[model samples]
Target: MSKQLPDLTPIGVVAIAALCTTSLLVGVRSLGALQRWELLVFDWMIRLRPDDPPDPRLLVVGITEDDLSRFGWPLSDRTLAQALNQLQQHDPAAIGLDLYRNLSQPPGYEELVAELNAPNLIGIENDNVDPPPTLPEARIGFNDLVSDPDGPIRRNLMTFEIEGKTRYSFSLRLALHYLQLKGLAPEVSPTGAIVWGKAVFEPLTSTSGGYATIDAKGYQILLNYRAEDRAVETVTLSQVLDRQVPPEWIEDKIIAIGTIAPSIGDVHYTPYSSTSSHPFMAGVVIHAQMLSQLLSAVIDGRPLFWFWSEGVEIAWILAWTVGGAAIAWWCRHPLLLVAVSAGGIGVLVLTTWGIFLAAGWIPFVTPVLGWAIAGSGVVAYRAYQSGRQQQIVMKLLGQSTSPEVADALWSSRDHLLKNGKLPGQKLVATMLFTDLKDFSTISEQMPPEALLEWLNEYLEMLTEVVQEHHGIINKFTGDGIMAAFGVPIARQQPEEIAEDAYNAVSCGLTMSDRLQILNREWQQRGLPVIQMRVGIYTGPIVAGSLGGKERLEYGMIGDSVNIASRLESCEKDRQSSICRVLIARETLTLIREQFVVEHWGPLALKGKHQMVDVYRVLARQQKTGEVPVEPPVDFPQPKR
Candidate 1:
């Protein structure tokens, strides 16, 4: 046997919950909504970082376009040697040569080579690029930058594996050289973050912080960039060679020397490039920024950017998912649910903005996605539930009342039920009772199968006729049907009340006329013919859903219903013939203008104690005052 599947309610709820969980997890693991949001938040945080003034202890000696024009692209060794000789005399703390100079040049090679050996100077290397020709392993530092997929540098590599050996980066080595004068060194933390004094230089991983998937090599950490507008005090290569710069601007400061020429292709896009007024930063300036950031944390006591562990981030996402699920469960209105979802999103945006500013990167996209998945899924499910419930209510009430009544009942179901019970109410309604004239006689004359076939033919006509006039076929009592109008669903307006009475009276006359046509068809088939007697009454009745929880049906249980049934069995009227259609005084009074009911006043029916006034509904009257023998006139349309 095949496995049994659960119904739609449970299935919808489970699907919604599963979607929320899966959407969040997939985002956390793969590159999707969460990753996109992480990148966006990262850009905002970088731009929002506190703008500090340039460090007074650092300086830059750059090769400008003017210098490149004056000395040409590849300056002679004599030019560099003279500039170094001028800078070293100032007694700076340390000097970092940010240029690649491994090749030998003409004229002053021996002099340039001698100046490269200063104890405080750091030479640059690029093993990943074309290897230059100068300096021992201990004297050279790597000068390569790691770019993201978008070609922007946010991480600063501290150490790299070159030729099967770990080598320090140029910026890292330069910062270390300067810090040595103050007697501070790096210590490895248990969590793998680099700690120096009170500062922790935590390196970013592929999944760390706001980065999605990234190249996480070289033991890199987040680069805390300096303010864009604050430029490092620079002197041209021409100024350094001429010895025109003041000694105080260079004395006791760490001076980084590099080329700032536009033709050198040393430019890179930073977080501030798109938003700030300044242009993109040069590669050497980026290095200087890295060095300054590190020294500031250790020497000036500034905080470094860091992130929470994966476990904490998962918990944070799960918490928001629960909140969204709860809101979905409580809110029912569609508009209110939409407003709530928007509010949840706003809270995430503002909260993440503040959190990133203070505590660095957190999981932003996954949490908001969790809210949307769980919340929207539940709301959509509720909407489906309401629709399905309406269909069920329409089918139920449709059996016993007009289409209008069924619709009204569905629209006001919440108001009708009190704690799962349908409350009883007094209603002004028209009750119709229909009985076949000689159904028993016909059943006896025919065989079982043929009898059922004939009975169905007659009942089918009755059902169709009653429903056409918007009258309910409440119950089939062996040979007859019990129906009620303005029941279960109440009529609030006077026009609607009058329309109910008119429909009931009109339906009775139509039933008689259709039965005559059905009899003509039966007579020609060599079968027994049948007729129906219908009674319509208008009065107060207690209408509502009645019975236990396992089974319930709409009902109008009152004296008015009994009187209509009694009229269906009534024997005679004014002509003392078959009473085909009878209308009581209570019903006739409400539909006096629309129906031409013959007054058969004060007939003492068996069930009632007092004498009741009744009438013989021979035919329906049109606006022209003539009673038509065929189909009844259309009832007046009721005011909405």
Candidate 2:
């Protein structure tokens, strides 16, 4: 009959879900800014260079210190012509010169121009207002730099407007050139960005004029770099000029040459940037990434497209919120609850990261925060509630009962206080009423000090007997004690009530014997000894907490109680009145096998409509150091 613990998970979950939803909305509204920051972090973390075998289609021909030392610094056009002529012998698939040829060089400038007119050559171009016209056949595309608002090279300018006409640039332009070389003219949208066939581009909504917002979904770029040198065949300008390396090293290879010197300030700080800056690597590496991307597009048919990761965020948030709440509510052990919550968070984080890597989607962060917050809140609340419940139990049962009974009472208070009615439940009970038989006479014989001390000692011993049998003492009248069994709570069986009565009888007999020794000692001292009479009855009765608000006590008031009190008074009528214990017929019937009893014929009892039969217990049968008392027989035959 203990109080039921309240469940708090559902409430906690609802609160967390609400917080998550709100956080999600806020995140979405700032999607563009979040995406930009995410990109910044990603760009800082992801290594652009390949850790294994290099992609076969991309090559970097470095303009190294070795090349410079071999050919002399800022070599004349004649020397450049010699280098170009040697490069032409290799017949590269495409050649991108990272240096601009806007001004004339030296004697072989025209021959260098003739070499630039080759079909697969691309040149770098600065964002100048005007420039001299160049041969269309040699200039496959232009390379232009695009930076962020803070002037960091974070975006690739695929196309830009010049003189009110859109012109393509950078790696995208090179990809277009490659496509044209393969006889596949890439479809161009009206906006001048190349239309990737069958690839859907859902641009994120933006409020900044016609400028498209860069959400986490809207940009998808890949890179390829080989860890091993010469993974993609490369012939330096010195090698080409000296014919030291094979001509086929560059033949049909997509050759990219650029500065890699740290002093020249040509190196870009990519996510993979390291201390070793071989002067010509920055532009060459970017070109390599672009080339690999283009080859992957053709061979693997992997299209880059935007996916809204918002749904994933919302789903994960709800999952953790519910899961955390469940753990907090269902787990009784504090450690287990904490372990479950932590394990849930770990699983969520791993799942989110895995899905992001596999499907390119980002989950919302607020859901995770919500789950943590809700779980902590629930645990704290549960602890507080548990403490409060314990305090209420202590307040109610602490003082009035024996420690053991108080604990039992507190635990079963729910059942005891059901419907707030007195004598709340039916129970098979034994009622015991004990009166100080000659207490007034003893008090008159003894000094007041001695009388009070003796009474307290007697009552203390008597109360112990009742409590030991799991019986509650209802109250103590001036010179008497009333105790009830199977009450305040109920016993499972009627036999237990009989057992309680027997125990009380045994305790009374022991007390009477012990008092004889005390009386002998007191007689020597010229003081009176006290005597008591006890009555027992067992029957069904209503038992529960009773009394008004401030004076509540667990008690039973019924006909059985009245009969037991009457039986106690009847003790004086017996021939052998020295033994002062009497039991009613009802109690005797339930314990016939236990206690041996002599019958007392039916006697008129006050406040009762009928005469009641009773019995006087004689002795108990002994077995294995324990005495077994049988129930009393029917009242003795009336004398003729």
Candidate 3:
């Protein structure tokens, strides 16, 4: 018979569970609200350390507290000129002033302006809502900070539109200044982000093209602070007015002179901020870092995106969803399921980190979560549905009959009903045939009502024994019962079914001994004593519904079954009477270790040409228990 599909309720439940899990994962990730505490821990663990060398070409001309102290409160313009003059001695390629010069202040302001007008100096500008025109000599660069959705300073502004014209800022402009210094000025892209002529310093590290992102401390480069006078051979504003400081100091190095006093507040947050360096110094260092990055690009070449992050994210989700579902379905245990889920998460994190570090790109996050959620959801749902179905089946079958019989019947009910026939279906089973020896004579000797009572009592005891061994009583003759094992269901090992048969026989022996006492009491009243013979055989049998529509019985019908009945009947015949409990050789094979059997030579039975080997089970050998063997060898024999 064709196998029927399993119950629908469980499948439905599993599908629902999978849907719920998918929805949850997608919802959480889309909102960016997933509390990734574990990811947070991982992020911290893998945070890059400081003191690493930044690109070397960039150089900082920091305006410090010492410069302020030496030149009076907010440093005067002449003092700035004097400082710039000293820095020019270094012969640096380019210089960037991180200070805004929109409005002027100080005695040496004009002199400072004259010095800034020099070829390599780049001045900072803010192109907020309104922007000033670029200086004729010095290149204007903007200093704009962009914040993340959570209000954290995470990105840098590369370009801004001022009055319908695009003006690039910070790193982009610094890169432009370096190109200008090489007489290789770049053409600006329409979007204001990319620089033409030279490849844009598009570090794959940042979401934006121009800037290389720094950690929260802000400094992208290590700050080497300069102290007063020691900061860079500082001279008084009067000394520079008198041309006392050497002209060589003001001839070559690109110089930046700005206030670093806490009161002035020119300082800003940077990654390299420390107890020694102020924020102004940090900004100066960042400017140097950007310049170095630009020069490196001009030299070593900029890195490209290794993988399309958007595509990666989508693929990850698909892979996780399909793969996770497969894994969850394959594993049934709760702990194993959890381990699989964790393993998936680990793989996802590892993949994300690997791509980020190696290719400098962030892969898609949504797809990975989708896979995991779908996988876990399906498995959990299936397990729940399975449990519910089991409960329903148990409630329906548990109390009506033997648990083993109930389980088997419930399991095979669909197949049996669909096929309409139970017999002729080959199944590995333990067939049991039990009969009351000389039952006809006993019935004839006793009154009808008394005989009926005695038969009911005998059947009840036998039925209990069969139930105790987890066997289903297939049918009962006038004074005989037949049971089966390993059908309607099968176990991992056939030996378990053999053990059940042995247990049933042992139970029968106990019941017989108990019945002996009752039979003796009946004997005193001139009634016949009752005795029974049982035979168990393990082999393939055809089991199904037997008889016509009105009265159908589920039973087995095959030669193995016929042999079992013959073996039981043999107990009464003189020639075959030596064995009280005869079991098939096949059954003996499974239980030879626990049972002691006397081999009964193969017999040629009626209607069968071939001889069948059989064994008479003498006793079950227990480590610490008695073997009950009644009905001595001299018991009166009956004709078969």
Candidate 4:
């Protein structure tokens, strides 16, 4: 009976693969390479977002090269005052001047200062620059953009502390001004998050999403770009000053005015602005995007970018690791493993990208790397284990079995072998014992070298006959050989056991015939001629690999094995042919009708208390017509 293959590799490989792959990925992630890849993936997803219509609540008044050419760089204070006055004439909800004005120009300096004092006008500043001196601290907001180490701006700094005073960002101030009319003011939630109306602006941590360690000093959040390119209605400074901009474009909307000329160098890289078509965004436009994000979240219920906690993210990575390992363990074929692994990765990528589209930022590259590495590790381990088992099985059988049997053994190795060793099993099998008739006398007559060579020749010929009959040469006993049939894999049906018995007898007869040829050859070469004795028995016996890892062999252990050995030496003086074969009743009973045998009445074997009926197998019963042989039933069968 064949045992089913255990689920050891499939089940155990997952744990091993996940543990090893996760450890490796986590360690490498600490080195920062994984975070870079994750950021790149984030950028790609952002770029793939569908284009959004321009925000109706905001407008950008850019100072273009054409405007710079028309009015010269850093337009005069009077020109800035004229533009601010024109925007105010439209009754805009709020206007952000994204330019430094710490020092005033001579002409219309009072006019610019008066405009800066307007309740709806907010002036920008940062640690490196100061706001217009005319604007009070309440009307000033910082414009600090936080860029990742790789040169792309992915985060927004909403607020910062300067001299023990908390200040809002320019974008946040504009958004708050717009929301103030709705009676929704920014308040701190119990969890220390900023809650403005319906949206909770969760602050980022040093290990948020894919960031290993970040300078998350100020209140920061992941920036979710509204579009791949500009998504706000825009007009140049000259267009506004020339009054080409319609009044409705600025009315009741947040307006931002800043330099957009490449030579002005106010441009910064964003997810959308990384391509050749739109490589960088004006600082003013980025602030506009941030304002749009905040207002839309509080008023329109648009979600801000959210991330799983570190624990959740770690669990997510482990899940994919197990997924990859499971795939590799189940798929033994190379092509199938690759195809399934690719499909697994595809699913992971789609899942993460979908979440990102919904404003959820999660790790992508770490999970992907963990998945691929775990699967590959399992595949390599399985391959190594298979090779090792094959070697052990081949060694156990002494490489003396037929190719068909050897292949069958290996294919069923997962069942027949365990932990690189074959466990002992009771099976109904045939044991054949062979020895030179007078080996000690023959060695005395010839030199040691000649004797060894002659003995090897006889054993080699007998080994071939044994293999041809589907039997395994278990071990060499110096001048003798021990072989087994219906072993490694136990025979379930009586017919299979009977067949094993018949084949053992047939192999003995074939060996006897080949010996005659060898005798003639040896006589011509002046070598000693020889005769041999073969004992065959079939019954229940224990079969398994015996000995430690250093030296192992297939062992047959049972009284049946001992009986077979005794038969070969019992009544040794009664030789009647070149090879005398003796069989116990247990073996003759199974093959009595196929082979002609002479019954040797009950006799005691060397190590047994019970008497046994032995027989001498002379030849096969040649028949002219088809004859049906009834299956043996009285023979001692192995327990199920």
lDDT of each: 0.75, 0.58, 0.55, 0.85
Top model number, TM-score: 4
| Per-residue lDDT of 378 in model 1 | 70
Candidate 3: count the clashes: 26
Over the stretch 1-640, how does candidate 4's per-residue lDDT look in tens digits?
5443333556787898898888788778777768888888888888787866788999999999998889886678999999999999999999999999888766789888888889999998888888888788878899988989888888989998879989999998888788997788989989999988879999998778888878999899888668755678889998898999999998898899999899999999987655648788888988888888888889988889888987788889899999999998888878998899899999998899889878888998998888888988888878877877887888888779988789788878888887668999999999999988667777888999988898899889988999999998988889889998888788999999999999999999888889888988998999877778899889899988789876787788998899889998888877768888899889888986888888888988888899989898887776768475432112122122
Model 3: per-residue Cα lDDT over 371-400, one tens digit each: 666775676556654555454434322232
List the candidates' TM-scores in order. Answer: 0.70, 0.62, 0.63, 0.88
RMSD of each: 7.5, 8.8, 9.3, 6.5
How much is the lDDT of residue 623 in candidate 2?
60
The C-alpha stretches of model 4 lying farther than 4 A from their native spots are: 1-17, 20-24, 31-33, 104-110, 273-276, 326-331, 376-391, 547-553, 570-574, 584-640
lDDT of 2 by residue, 1-640 (tens): 5663543345654565446544653465354444444444334333332354566655666666676776665656677667667777877777776665676677778878787777777776666622214646235345544433333344444454557765655465566666666765556577634456443323332321111253222222333233323334555667657778666567776667665444445655443443334312355565566565555555455454233454554555566666665577667677887787778778876765554444243433444555665566666666665565445444433333466666776566544443333336877778888887656666777788877777776677667666665666777877778877655567776566667666666655555555556656766876655556778887777765566534555557678888888888874645343346778787777667665677877888777889888777665645666655443222222222
lDDT winner, 1 or 3: 1
Clashes of each: 1, 14, 26, 0
Residue 640, candidate 1: C-alpha displacement in angstroms: 44
Residue pairs with clashing backbones, model 4: none
User: Across residues 497-523, which tens digit of lDDT does each residue of candidate 1 receive?
Assistant: 889888888887777677767767887
Query: What's the best-to-worst order under lDDT?
Result: 4, 1, 2, 3
